[model samples]
Target: MEMNGSQRIEASREQVYAALNDVEVLRQCIPGCDSIEKTSDTEMNAKVTLRVGPVKASFTGKVTLSDLDPPNGYTISGEGSGGMAGFAKGGARVVLVPDGEATMLNYAVSAEIGGKIAQLGSRLIDGTAKKLAGDFFSKFSQIVGPQPAGDDAPAAEVAEKKGWVGRLRDSL
Candidate 1:
């Protein structure tokens, strides 16, 4: 399957780029993510549970970041297996453009599945992928975007009080 879309984040390109690279931020943003651990600057391992159609399974995967351009963007790719449930692999090319104080995030995705999951039909699989992508970007934007008016806690202070995820959600 293939999909593409964009979002306007209420943050600078630098902030959005940094957050995209942060494993902790990704752990929170990804729907059904159990954990994400950074293995290297460009690699991560993740465990996620997903329900597609009537099949629910836990997936263990490795994600890689490539074609790096610092605050500009990068391509993210990954593949995972869920035993009899089947396997999935996909890649996304991401671009970040500065729009004044906000950043416009653009992405193009291509994915494929094999085994039992593929039998679920293209309509089901495509719908699931689109929903998952939307969920991920929406949460990511909310975390790294901007806080509402009258909220003035410094990020460090928020981190001290509520930890990294909270700080990212509330301050950064």
Candidate 2:
């Protein structure tokens, strides 16, 4: 399956790029992520639990980033196995562009799955993937966005202005 989209992050391009590469930040942003360990400047291992429809499984995977261009994004690819559930491998090319006070993160992704997960059907898998992606970006933006100086009210206002979900829906 192939999925592509972009998110408007409420931060500078450099800030967005840095957060994307930060293992701790990614671990928090990714839904059901158990852990993320950096093995090298451009490589990491991850453990994640995901549910696609009625099937839930744990995945252990390795991700590598290539085509380095600091503060401009890079290519990411990874593969994982979920025991009896299935296996999945995918790659994404990400690009970051400055947008005034914010950054626009664009990504194009393609993936393939096999075993029981594949039997669940493409529609289900596709929807689940999109949902996961949306969740990641939404959480990421909230973490990376500028915090209000002193109030919870302004935080909600910031979230509204960020419009992460609205942007994702528009892209899809």
Give me the candidate number with maximum TM-score. Answer: 2
Q: For model 2, what is the error of residue 123's alpha carbon versus the real structure, in angstroms, after optimal superposition?
A: 0.7
Model 2: lowest-lDDT 10 consecutive positions? 147-156
Off by over 4 Å in 1: 150-172
Worst 10 residues of 1 by lDDT: 148-157
Tens digits of lDDT, candidate 1, 1-172: 8999999999999999999999999999999999999999999999999999999988899999999998999999999988899898999999999999999999999988998889999999989998998899888987898764554546444566786787678754
Model 2 misplaced regions, further than 4 Å: 153-172
Cα lDDT tens digits for candidate 2, 1-172: 9999999999999999999999989999999999999999999999999999889999999999999898998999999999999999999999999999999999999999999999999999999999999999999998998765668867667666869996567568
Quote the positional error of residue 159 for candidate 2 in Å. Answer: 14
> Mind sharing the TM-score for model 2?
0.87
- What is the model-wide C-alpha lDDT for candidate 1? 0.91
